[model samples]
Target: MTKKQPKSDATRRRNRVDSSTRQPKPPKSDPNNFHGSNNHHFLAIIAVVFVVSSAISAFLYRRINHPSLPPSFAHQRGLVKEDVTFQEILTENSRVSENVTQRHFTNPVLAYITPWNSAGYDLAKRFCPKFTHLSPVWYDLKSQGTKLVLEGRHNADTGWMSELRLRGNAQILPRVVLEAVPKDLLRSKKQRDKAIDLLITECKDIGYDGIVLESWSRWAAHGVLHDASLRKLALQFVKQLGDSLHNVRSQRNGQPLQLVYVIGPPYSESEKLQAHDFGPEDLRTLSDSVDGFSLMTYDYSSSYSPGPNAPLTWVHSTIKLLVGEGGKSLANKIFVGINFYGNDYVVAEGGGARAITGRDYLSLVDQYKPTMRWQKDFAEHFFVYSDDQHHEHAVFYPTLMSIAERLKEARSWGAGISIWEIGQGLDYFFDLL
Candidate 1:
């Protein structure tokens, strides 16, 4: 009844305001507020998807690009398996053989075979034509009282020897090491006679064309070379052995047996102060007795320091010392030793260096993708790399170019070359031979 009586303008306006507030006035539209809440949820979902997608992409990329290497590469970087087939080796050798020019070498090309590495056996058969003499590192001359006994005859492969002779006409000279005491063989005439007879009998019985005797180093280690009287007796013993072997005939080829004397390199002046092994004097003394002198020219560096395996300068100096004034005649009989292996040294603490094969050299190259460098002075290949644990390493190895340089140098000196053992080298190494 009171509201019906109120008809004033102020009253009407106040009543209208009150009615609008109570009825909510059909709710106004605020575009920013409405869209902001919905956009926040949409952006959050998009962000999560982007983050997950990015993580997946990164993982996939790493897996696709980088693969794990063999477990053997994990430790002992020096030793690695030559993961190649015989046919693959033959294929590579065939490719290398195509570019080879046929040239006759006046001197013998000796290749050594080791029983431990089966690759040497296969390679010897494959590249038989490249060598004039094949020396299997077998046979040790040990003494039992007055009688002399021979060991390591079980390693002889008659079938392999027969194949080698037939295919390449190479002489099979089994390497003989004098494991007996120096006094037993050098001092006693009866012992020397027995030793000579033992070698000759083995050569005749085993169809060996010759014997590669390695006793000077042993005798030198035993201080036999230091004593004047013992040295003379040692030379006489070698002469006697050589003369007896030359007198005997090989059962396989009616030819006189050959005797190769393995001699150590001349020690440096500093090294001579410590110990003296066989030098130029020994080479000359045994020149008339032995058919060939195997000069050990490698091992210029030791594991204590990172240096070349065989420095070119050192090699030249060594050859110069041995083949003195107009000594090309002696050089013809000398077989310069060439190493096919390499060395890897770790620069970090508790790290040491070791000898590495071609396969091992290649594995390191693949894993690290390091910058390879050619040591111009030493004529070798080397590189530096960091391992997974951030350890730095230096590697020195022989390449085709380095090996070719050595071959050319030896040929220039009119000296034959002897690989330490063919198994330690790459398949293409025989191409130089």
Candidate 2:
């Protein structure tokens, strides 16, 4: 509005330029700048940014505190629980069973009996004395007579362990069992020497009080020991026992430590059982070879008892037979037998079919509190029945009451009983004897 200088070209050009054509200001290039250096717009912008930042931070924080689920870890400390945090022990309803925890006597035992054959028995209701009503079978043993052995390799995941991940390992392994092989098959002199060294180390590793060398592992065709080298090697093994970890076993005022060998009577017996004439010499050789004897008295007459009736008399006769007629003191070194389960067989018309047994008969019974009948001579009771399929089944389960009776009998007979095994495979199979 300065009165009109329509003067120069530059001035006219400037005049033609519209003030409205000028560019607005650029945004401030920094995080500090919320809005233009002008109004309350900057304060509103700052507030919005804070809430968004806080939400992202919180989501990230929560993610770090919680993690994944649990898996069974074998290397856990102590008796680990099934499904819980590693730091927490499952102290729920599974308390220690009394059958497993009954009084452990330290009375010097006359003999230690192992139900060796208890290994393979089905422990089904038919075979076991107590569980005739509920057929829960013991799973991981291999028994051949009164002798039993556990090879945790095939057992850790069966029966009570069918579902759980079996995490622990047994005290012994195949290599350990093989370590004690005799000098005959031994190739190198160093190996024979090392067999002694390694066996002692292995035994120490496995917490064994003593070892029972099964005759089946090494025996002569005549059922007597063939290799004098094996006996000599045995002495070396015993020397290791007496000298190494578990010190010398002192039976009478600390005598030399010893190990035992159970030379089984031939597993196969002909219809005409062996008398003193046929097997006595072999028995004598076997007796001379080991510190003691383990006599398997279970499957003699093809039946658990003399009759189909429960608790037939052979249970006592088995012990009586061990004490040869006119013998002064019984073998005094004998460990007798007992069966965890019973047997079943098909009587072929030819009278030649081998008896059916594996104690699998218990699988057929309806054992929901079946009645228990006692037999006096055998000191135990048993059951025999047929399945719907017409297959005959027999069972001999033991309850705590029955086991107590067995213990008493065993003590009177000159020793304590070694339970067929240490397994948790029965429904209520723990001794209700």
| Clashing residue pairs in candidate 1 (N, C-alpha, C atoms within 3 angstroms) | none
**lDDT, residue 101, candidate 2:** 25
**Residues 23-96, model 1: lDDT tens digits:** 11111112122122133432243234234322234233333443322222111222212232223322343244
Q: What TM-scores do the predictions have?
A: 0.75, 0.42
Q: Local error of candidate 2 at 241, Å? A: 7.6
Off by over 4 Å in 1: 1-95, 98-106, 270-275
Report the lDDT tens digits of candidate 2 across residue range 1-433. Answer: 0011112211211221211111112222132332122323323432343333222332333224323211112112222212222112122112333342232321122211112333322332122222101111112223323333434333222342221112211111111122122333243355444444544443444333334443233323322234455544444543343344235433222333234433333322221223211133333444433444444444332221111211223333334444545441445555444334333322211111122212232332333223343443334444434335543333444333344444444445554333323231232323222
TM-score of 2: 0.42
lDDT of each: 0.64, 0.31
lDDT of 1 at 385: 70
Error at 181, model 2, angstroms: 8.1
Candidate 1 scores a C-alpha RMSD against the true structure in Å of 31.5
**Each prediction's RMSD to truth:** 31.5, 37.6
